[model samples]
Target: MDIIKKRRSVREYLDKPVEDEKIEQIVEAARLAPSSCNSQCWRFVVTKGDIKEQIIKKGLGGIVLANRWAKSAPAIIVACADLNFLTHKVGAGIKGIEYHLLDIGIAVEHLILRATELGLGTCWIGWFNEREVRKILKIPRSIKIVALITLGYPKGELELHEKQRLDLKKILFWNKYGNCEG
Candidate 1:
C-alpha cells in the first residue's frame, strides 16, 4: 500500500545513474507478471545513449505533452510483443488480442510498483508513433510495440493533487447497472 500510494507519474528526474542491478530487479519483477496462457510474448528493450536519444525524439512526435520530460529520463524501456506468438500457439488460431494487451498492462504495472519500491520513479508512455518507434528500434514488422516507460530517480517530492473520479454511487451497482443512488 505504501508503494502504491508513492507511485506517481514522475516527469522530472535527478541527474543520477540508476544501478544496473536495480534495473535487473525491476525487469525481473516484470518478467514474473502473469501472462495470457503463460505465453509470455512480451519483449523489453532497455535503451540508453544515442539509441535512447533517437527513440525519445522519434517517439515523442505523436505525444505533445510529455516529450520534454521523457527526454530527461535516464533510461527508457520499450515494451514490444510478438503478435503471432501472442495470438497463436503451436498451430493454434487467434486466441484474443485483449488478452495480450491485458498481459502487457499487468507487466507494466508490476514494473511501476517495483520502481516505487526501489525508491525510483517511472512514467508509462503510450502516446507514440508506433511506426517510427519500430523503425528507430529496428524491430521486426511482426512485433508490436505496446508501451515505452521512462525511468529515473525523481527530481523532487510529488505533491498530491486532486484527481477527478466517478463517485461510488455513480460507478458501483448492487446487482445491476444504474441501481445505486447518490
Candidate 2:
C-alpha cells in the first residue's frame, strides 16, 4: 500500500543513469506476473545513451510532442509482445479477446510497482511511431510493440500531493452492473 501510494506518472527526471541491478530487479518482478494460459509473451528492451536519443528523436517525433519530456529520462524500457504465442491468436479468434495485451498490462504494472519501490520513476508512453521504434530498436517484425516507459530518478524532491481517484462506491458493484450495495 505504501508503494502504491508512492507511485506516480513521473515526467521529469534527473540526468543520472539507473543502475543495471535495479533494472534487472524490476524486470524480474514483471517476469513473475501471471499471463493468460501461462503464455509469458512479454519481452523488454532497455535503451540508454545514443540509442535512447534516437528513439526520442526519430520515434517520438511529430504529433507526440507531449512526450518530448522523456528525453530527460536516463533510461527507456520498451515492452513488446511475441505474437507466436498460440493462446493469444486462438483466444482472439474464438472470443475476440486480445489476451496478450491484458498480459502485458499486468506485467508492466508489476514492473512499475517494483520500480517505485526502488526509488525510480516511470511514465507509460503509448503515443509513438511504432514503425520508427521497431526500426530504431531492431525489433523483429514478428514482435508487437506494446508500450515505452521512461525511467530514471525523479527530478527534485517528491511531491506530497494526493492522487485523485473516483470513489469505490461509484465504480464497485455488488453483484449486478448498477447495484452499489450487496
Alpha carbon lDDT of each predicted model:
0.81, 0.93
Tens-digit per-residue lDDT, 7-89, candidate 1: 88988888887888988999999999998778887789998879888887777765554565787889998988777762444
Best by TM-score: 2
| Off by more than 4 A, model 1 | 62-66, 86-97, 158-164
- Residues 1-182 of candidate 2 have per-residue lDDT tens digits of 88888889999999799999999999999999999999999999999999999999988998888899999999999999999988899999999999999999999999999999999999999999899999999999989999999999998655445789988787888767875354
Q: Candidate 2: lDDT of 41?
A: 96
Between which residue pairs do clashes occur in model 2? none
Task: Report the CA-based lDDT of candidate 1 relative to the real structure.
Answer: 0.81
Candidate 2 lands at a TM-score of 0.95
For candidate 1, the TM-score is 0.86
User: How many pairs of residues in model 1 come into backbone collision?
Assistant: 0
